[model samples]
Target: MLKEQFKQLAIGVAAFTFSCATAKAATTITVAVTPTAANAIVDLVADFVNANPTYDVAVVGSSDSLSKDAIVAGGATGPYDLLLAQSYSVPANLKYYYPTLVSGDPFPFAKDTLVLYSTTVDISQGIPLQLQAFSLPDPATADPYGVAAVQALGPEYLYAQGQSLTIKTADAGGSYAQVAYLGTAYGFTGKSQICTAVTNVDQYEPGSFHHEYVLGQDYTTDIVLAGVKIARTRTVDQETALTAFVNFLVSAKATALQHHCYKLPSAQ
Candidate 1:
């Protein structure tokens, strides 16, 4: 009976040791991104984790103010080790906020085109002459895509942007919802969201296809995304893991994923 008890105790200790080792082997870092890049970041983080088992990346979607506020609030050793925002301005802004905390130029990753899409009506007429009611991201907000959408519509339609009848939301996802689900005439959204229709994906499938008008330089503003590696006091393991993930983001595979349906930073 004593021998059996001894054997059980040995197994318990072994299990605890193994568990502790497994936990130590893994290092996690957070990458705060704007909502426009959330899906792309998720896919990219998945690839990074699969390649480096020692690292786990957490993706957080932030608004313009919230994005910078989070890092500033966290200080030098913040939760966000990296930041991927809708435009290159983010890095510049960070530099202004805390010069020492931000190092190096922001990496231009991808450019997302703004698109006008509709399922309930025809938009082939080009920019609508008038809208009884419309849906869009609030142009007043600092969201790059939303501002680009307003710029695409031009001054004649500025009132339409703030009209009481229009539906305004936070990000591209909400703009998509206004038209895709809520049936709000037509709306503006990111090209990445609708590129390459997938099976059973709502509004992107064969049956629920949306008529899309791709707005290029002739119609809309350029929407490029950039990421900046933040400098923070971290453990050696965490810093190494963070460097590896950032390197992977610029890798060929990651670049392709980031540019899926969008322009490569180098391309434009």
Candidate 2:
């Protein structure tokens, strides 16, 4: 009877040990993404979790400038394991972080172009005079789309007419929302945002809007969407999980998913 009790105790101890090991093997990776890519990142995370059942993924979406600031300041150590930002801003903003917060070079995943959006404009008639106010992303704050939008309004462009334009700066998502639902007459944002607005009009403003490609005339400025991995601030297992997630983001499947919202790099 004593031997039987010892055998049962050993079995229980072994089972508990196995459970602990399994729990330790499971990892969670957090990703910080720009507001423009929020929806697409959510979908990509869902697909990644499906393929990697042992790993859990979380996504936080914010402005490009804010996201870069968080990672560079080491605020992302406990919150985010990776960051997705505009390619134009990455090199300049992330250079200081180096191998500590930023693992390596940014991987270009997609591209976006600046465009004009309006709910009350008749594009067939060309630039309208009633379009007095414009919503744009803040170029000073590291928004490449905003910079492109400003370039599109240069003297060389057709819209550089004598009419004075009122410009309001906002983030990518905010810029889109201003045109789609906030009753802004003209909004400047990425073409991908226009695609998102058109694809989900009913879900957003439930109204008709027009989008025109204005930046094509000025190709000096381009927007590329890229992803960068955060430094290994967590356990080695967690670092491996984070690396895997970043690799999956550049995979063909992930690129296809990104193309649904933004233009791919190769498509440029």
Candidate 3:
């Protein structure tokens, strides 16, 4: 009876030790990202998690808004392990406004091109002033895609300074506006948002017959997507996880996923 009790206690201790080991191996890395990358990271995190069973990725916020949140929280990364945006603005702001939060130089992972897409109007001739243009991403916020669209559309189409505008606002002509998104029927958006199967991923690449919409032009502007690590308040586990994820963003595995909606500088 004494021997049996000792054996049972040993087994229970071993099982508890195994459970602790497994729990320690699991690490979750949170990323603050722009709209496009937010959707793209779903596939990316799946692949990353597959490769490194111990790690998982969670996403939150626009690149600019999240940075503002971090600044408000103090010179820290806040809740995110990384920041991925459509331009250099995230790192640039952190560098000038809050340098201590940054871990290293930001790196571009993919290039997205702007295109005029329309399901309601024939856009072959370009910029149908008849319907006018709606607000786009705020250029003041340094959204590169919105900046490109606003710049290419010129003053006539730009109606406001922020995102999500109505036709009434476009008619009023406040300032500059973003064309792509749900509210506007016909407007400019990233090529990656439309591209599904094509592998080349050039900025000017035409959409295939399967596309639900019509193209206005060959292409407009090339937008770059960049990511950076946040150094402050990082744990030993996150230090390893962040490095692996950043390296993976630029790796061949991520290249194909990014190419689904964008072009790499080397590929271009």
| Candidate 1 Cα deviation (angstroms), residue 45 | 1.1
Which of 1 and 2 is ahead in TM-score?
Answer: 1
Please give the TM-score that candidate 1 achieves against the real structure. Answer: 0.78
Q: Summarize candidate 1's per-residue lDDT along 81-168 as a digit string, tens digits.
A: 8888777776778977687776577887777777776766776454576675766667777566777777676764567746765677
Any runs in candidate 2 off by more than 4 Å, and if so which? 1-26, 75-77, 124-126, 156-164, 196-207, 214-216, 266-268
lDDT of 2 by residue, 1-268 (tens): 2112122221212111011112343376667776666656666777776787676776776655666666667643545677787564664457554555667777787777666766666443334654566777777765787777667666523353344454545565567666565677767766665454224231212244545554457645767787777764777778877877777777665753443456565444
In candidate 1, residue 56 scores what lDDT?
Answer: 66
**Residue 167 CA displacement from its true place in model 3, Å:** 5.6
**Cα error, candidate 1, residue 159 (Å):** 4.9
Residue 26's lDDT within candidate 1 is 39
User: Model 2 scores what on Cα lDDT?
Assistant: 0.60
What TM-score fits each model?
Answer: 0.78, 0.74, 0.69
Leading candidate by TM-score: 1
